[model samples]
Target: MPCPACQAPSPCPQPHVGTAWKPSPDVTVERLSPGLPRRLPLRQILCLLPLALVVVVAVQHRSVLADGFGHLATAEWPWLLAAAAATCLTWVAAAVTRQGALVERLPRRRLLATQFAAGAANHLLPTGLGASAVNLRFMAVCGVPLARSSAALALYMLAESVARVGLLVALLIAFPDALRIGVLLPDGAAGPLLLAAGAVVCVALTVLLLVRRVRTVVFSFLRTALSEARSVHARPARALALWGGAITFPALQAAGLAAVGQALGLPVPPLHMAVAYLAATVAVALVPTPGGIGSVEAALIVALVAAGGPAAVATAVVLAYRIITVWLPLLPGALTLGALVRWKVI
Candidate 1:
């Protein structure tokens, strides 16, 4: 007799008798199982999508970009170079902060690349969502548990916020008149703004205290974050990297704006320009705009004017600074982000 399915000489008519039938090595199991799912090409699509979007955005904003470059062309080269340097250093500062948040050591190159990719993603999503999402993925990929990663992210954010406010207060103490809130706001707006901010904080605190489930989650998160922070601070290098990077990050950003101001011949003093940059960024930090795009530009322009620069000049400086700090690196960052996706780095 011969086996029916895979015909071969056999003692019995049954397919399983004598010798078991087997598909040739060249045939895959998928060939036998018709219902097997094919692998999706999602990673490749994700890798390319951002790059395509970047090109489209660049093309659509060609005129504005060209004008910004034109301004840079005639501006002071040395100051522009310094601004570029500061822009580059911001990535490094970000990477250091990320490393400080984790106890495990990430590969240096990949970690830095993740930060670069995170920067691109940050602009694509509202506030810091893009960056936070990327970092979370990266940490998970690096073997950090989800809860720990989330805690580390919270700690990083807290540290950065504290450092920014501390720097702002220090600057205000040093230059009391650098920015007048009264001048920036309408006659009756300042008091209302303060009250609104206070009300929001109180509401949030009340909700956290009143909701049992929410309070439990919040307490769990805080405990995890505190534990992680304590562990990180136990090591001197990590402590320095966390706090030092946090402080330096905003300072470098402020320096970049001041450098741009100098490059464009803005009449604001350097310290005043720094103050304006910090204040504008801090004020717009809560805005849900992607990378604070529109809000940041408007705020920066206003802050610069309030800091004693002419409105036209302030506008020009803001445009130029955004070009150098945001627009120029955008394409490269997108490309890098896509590469990281394809490589499964995030």
Candidate 2:
């Protein structure tokens, strides 16, 4: 509308024009494709290539994959029960770790659900993104502030790593000759190297925790979250116990593999499976893929075979392990994730 002072048939204001209509800010739109060709669609297609490759492999190896179905039949009821017990222990240990890391109280049931859901998502999602996302969402839903939730996640992850490293070290030390046999490690001194690496990681983590400034920066964001977990009792004793559980989690998985080996009647010892299993697991974690998918399966098969298990047997064991540890939980996780969404918990 024209100003009254200079009005000569001024434009009429329509419906609270001046009162409610502040000038809209100018939004400049630049041509992002000025020089570069639009390649995102191509990139998206390429991104899916790996998944396609996995499907092809699965199809090609359908017979071998089908043979893996026999694993369920081979499952000795007694050992299966033991594996189940170990799995339960895994959750118990995780709850303890969460409690320790929170330095506050967390419901055991919730933590365990989070654990299972995270694992399940990790498996179902194309990349491990689904699982980590689930974990963050779960923590948020549990009333942990985002910052403290992050700290809790970091601590929990570290604890899990420590456990894995510990188990690896134990196996390496207990069976030095086996390490000397593996193709993955440097000749004659891998044991010391693995041990050294584990020690270094531990020391670095400890140092990070000890540095006040670093701690402040790393954990400041978690204050709101930790405060929410005020009921969580932070006891050093409990922390250690939780760490113990983290260690056992991997150990239980290893034991499961051993049980599979026995069920398959493979000649390789359980300790050998443990070492190979740990190595493959660590390797898979380093891969960029979600849940390590193709990489994990390949690594496990290679490691198990290199450790003297038959190729088909290794594949079978890995497949069975994934089925039990991954697929079994995925169905429930999807259901829970839906529930979480419906309830706006996420």
Best by TM-score: 1
lDDT of 2: 0.66
Q: Which stretches of candidate 2 lie over 4 Å from their true place?
A: 1-65, 74-77, 126-128, 180-182, 185-234
Model 1 lDDT, full chain set: 0.89
Q: Write the per-residue lDDT of candidate 1 for residues 80-179, one digit (tens) a residue.
A: 9999999999999989988888787888899899988888888877879999999999999999999999998998999999999999999999999998
Can you write out model 2's per-residue Cα lDDT over 78-124, one digit (the tens) per residue? 75566556655665666666666675466676667666655645655
Error of 1 at 13 (Å): 4.5
* TM-score, structure 1 vs. true: 0.89
